[model samples]
Target: MSETTMNTATGATAARGRGAVALTVARVVLALFFAFSAFAKLIAHESAIESFDRMGWSHGAMYLIGALEMAGAVALLVPLLSGVAAMAFVGLLAGASVVQLTLLDPVNAIMPTLLIVLVVLIARDRQDSTAQLIALVRRRA
Candidate 1:
């Protein structure tokens, strides 16, 4: 290949490598975040308890969210399930964002809003994998 062609090819490959690394990093960070959040709720942390009570949610609701958060964290690391997990987090985080903006300080909504954007990117990036998973399940059914 010509030098220009080789440079272009190499650059494209490098860009893909970077994209993969970014995706991996995002997944790990999201997993750790949700895991810790779940731990906080499961332990009945004072803030979590107060927040749930203020929201008119029962202890059961808190526990359910904690469990779901843990499951979503695990799912984020699984190749076939990462997209699914991200999609789920989009809704979960959206709800949390709304609650933050409406019930608590609007400033508290920042994290969940940013998380929603990240998960949206992750979901878009993993669209093909998610599609394949859906196809496999369809075939099995």
Candidate 2:
């Protein structure tokens, strides 16, 4: 191969490596945020129940939501599952945002909205990574 072609290939590989690292970092940060929230809800049942009551939801619903959050958070740590987890959180966050806007202050809705954006970004990044992996596998085959 020509020298310029080799350099181009090397640069492309380095860029892909950097992209993977950034995606991994984002996944970990998001996973930690969701996990902490879930832990709080699970450990402080009274607080969670009160929060749910304010939202016109039952205490049982609070527990169920917390469990779902915990499951999604755990899935986020797995590379293959992070995309699905992010997609799930996008839906969950959307519901939370709507509830916050309707029942609480507009300011309260901002966090869930922001989280939805982050999860969407993670989902897109994961999709790109998956596509690249599939392309590589096809090339090998």
Candidate 3:
């Protein structure tokens, strides 16, 4: 290959490397946030429980959401599963944002709404990987 071509290829490779690093870091941060929230709900922590109660939600609702959050958090840490996790988070956080706006403090809705944006970015970035995973599963099945 020509020297100029090699340099171009190297630059592209470096860019992709940086993108991957950024995505991985984002995933880690999201995992931490969701895991913390999940534990609070699962443990019936004072603040978490009170928030649910104030919304007129039962214990079951709290537990169910907590479990789902925990699962998503775990999935976020796994490269293959992170895309799926991001997609799931978009849906979950959308519901949370709606509830926060309608049933709870409207201010509280900002966090979930922002998180939805972040997860959507992650989902878009990892779409190729997600498609590959689905393709592999289909081939196997």
Best by lDDT: 1
| Model 1 poorest 10 in a row by lDDT | 99-108
TM-score of 3: 0.87
Clashing pairs in 1: none
Scored by CA lDDT, what does every candidate get? 0.94, 0.84, 0.92
TM of each candidate vs. truth:
0.94, 0.77, 0.87
For model 1 the TM-score comes to 0.94
lDDT of 3 by residue, 60-97 (tens): 99999999999999999887788889999999999999
Clashing pairs in 3: none
lDDT of 3 at 96: 93
Q: Where does the lowest 10-residue lDDT sum fall in candidate 3?
A: 75-84
| Candidate 1 structure quality by residue, lDDT tens digits, 43-127 | 9999999999988889999999999999999999998999999999999999999999988778999999999999998999989
lDDT digits (tens) for residues 1-141 of candidate 2: 999999999999999899878878988988898888898787766767678878888767777888899999999998767887888999999998998888867789999998888888788888865566568779999
